[model samples]
Target: MLVTERTLAREIAPAVERSLPGVEVLAVEMLSPSRFCVYVDHPEGVDHALCARVTQLLDDYRASYTIDVSSPGVERPLRKPAHFRAAVGQEVQIRTATPLAGKKRFRGAVVAADERHLRLAAGDEAVDIPYEAIVRGNLIDEGQVQP
Candidate 1:
């Protein structure tokens, strides 16, 4: 079996942690044979300018390797139910592997959720989608970030 870039990245995380404290390492996926993507984050109240400086440091040493840096947005995105629960009252973008009501994607405000489903409202219409039916979902940021 072939090991994924994410797997390789996971293996390398401990080393990274030793060098960058308090940075949230989200994922490391291979973009090509030599290129890799690194997703990272820090606490909400941390200084973003300093975070960018550290991202640059990571990129600098690995000059030969392509590094894409970014932070999680509004939907931050739900990889699990806990993520969904953490994002109540936020807008989100949901995509399903199979079409729902003829469409495979939906965007709306997340009004509520239970063990089995999530309630989303787009304008005045509220829809209930089974938790199992959601392939991936991200919380969207509706407001501008203050600098």
Candidate 2:
């Protein structure tokens, strides 16, 4: 089976969270065949020490891939229901795997989110996007910085 960022994120997130309380793994991305980025967030905020610790926790991947542990920065990724739940009332950009209503991308403030879906106030209409359909989703900072 081909290893993907999403699969790796799901597999690695739980382990990371178990080891580091309050640290959430937001997303994982394959930068190249031998390199990858692990976006992590902590309630106390991420610092060099936290990043280094996460890097150490994931040392096993170093044999095959160069892991870059990072703070989510201004634009944090949204993957699981908890991520979206915390994003309520915040602007976001969501791209769906399948087009909904002639559109694949939606940008708006998240109004509500549940286990299976989230409601987005895009333009004049509110859109309901299923969690499984989200190909990519991230916070839209709009010139504002966040922890």
> Over the stretch 86-134, how does candidate 2's per-residue lDDT look in tens digits?
9999999998878987899989999999999999997799999998888
Error of 2 at 88 (Å): 1.7
lDDT of 1: 0.64
Off by over 4 Å in 1: 1-38, 44-67, 73-75, 114-117, 130-136, 144-147
What residue pairs are clashing in model 2? none
Q: What lDDT does each candidate get?
A: 0.64, 0.88
Q: Candidate 1: which pairs clash?
A: 74-139, 75-138, 75-139, 75-140
CA error at residue 123 for candidate 2, angstroms: 1.1
TM-score of each: 0.53, 0.86
- lDDT at residue 110 of model 1 (Cα atoms): 80
* Candidate number of the best lDDT: 2
